[model samples]
Target: MHTSTEFLLALWTLAVVEGLRVTEVVVPPFLVIGQRARLRCHFALEGEVLYSLKWWKDGSQFYQFIPRNDPKMVVFSVAGVTVNVENSNLHEVELVDVQTSSSGQYRCEVVAEAPTFNTHVLSANMTIIGKGRGALSTSAQFYLLETVNFGTQHHPYRAPWHALP
Candidate 1:
């Protein structure tokens, strides 16, 4: 009977160990292309968590999400991508207009100030699938500006004889 109890205890310990892997963070696996999606990072600690939280891609440096005026964290709105952030119990990162480039491994970095500990980083990987069957649409501005430009002669407010030499 004692041996059976010990075996059960060992099994529970193994389960706990598997559950608490301190490496990569967990985020939603799937997101639609050309749409907004959120990535979350959560850390577990006993005491206060006063630290500078940051994010990065590949081997780049830290990324700041707050204080919009910071030049290091420029508000970049590319043709196919946009980034926004929110800090709370879990850090929420929004990726807008996701494209093929958005599908990659991402990292979440944490620096604990009060504890004076070295920086800790957590990673999460994702894959963005293409929208099938003409799911994506092009912007209308392309057709309006270059292809459908109306000269002043045809304009409703401009008189046709005004520009005649």
Candidate 2:
């Protein structure tokens, strides 16, 4: 008895009212080798209860948080991802002594509990740069350029050759 438009509108209303959304994903675009990095995932759960929060690096899951679990937190090992589990939780994760190999796409996935089990995901890229040995490596220079183009407000990317030493 309902028109197509009415049905579509009702679906939209339901989703908007009961949806879990990832509002922001904060991953530093660049970092110096051996420096620590903090990644944050912010979400809007609307009226849904949180089921789990997960962090993935280059398609490999490295961290998870489940509110109903015994410990509520779990960690997995992935190449180049050294999670500082002691400082990690639902809202943020910290990585200690990041290395050049840590550069990769990072994703945050959030799921809602119970019958619906709605899920949402968001991702960002990060790059790690080593100090100049003698001259900058080709990949390092490339990363510097890329960071200049797409840099975060908190850590504005800059290349100061003189400051290297």
Candidate closest to the true structure, highest TM-score? 2
Q: Evaluate model 2: give its TM-score.
A: 0.77
lDDT of 2 by residue, 67-151 (tens): 8998999999988899888898899999999997899999999999988889999999999876655555454322253343345
| Backbone collision tally, model 1 | 0
lDDT of each: 0.52, 0.86
Give the residue spans of candidate 1 off by over 4 A. Answer: 1-24, 65-81, 85-90, 133-165
**Candidate 1 structure quality by residue, lDDT tens digits, 1-165:** 479889999999875443212345665555556767676767544343434556565555335543323442433333333575442223566776777676666677765445444356678766555544432344211111113337744433421111112
Residue pairs whose backbone atoms clash in candidate 1: none
Best by lDDT: 2
Off by over 4 Å in 2: 1-10, 13-17, 135-165
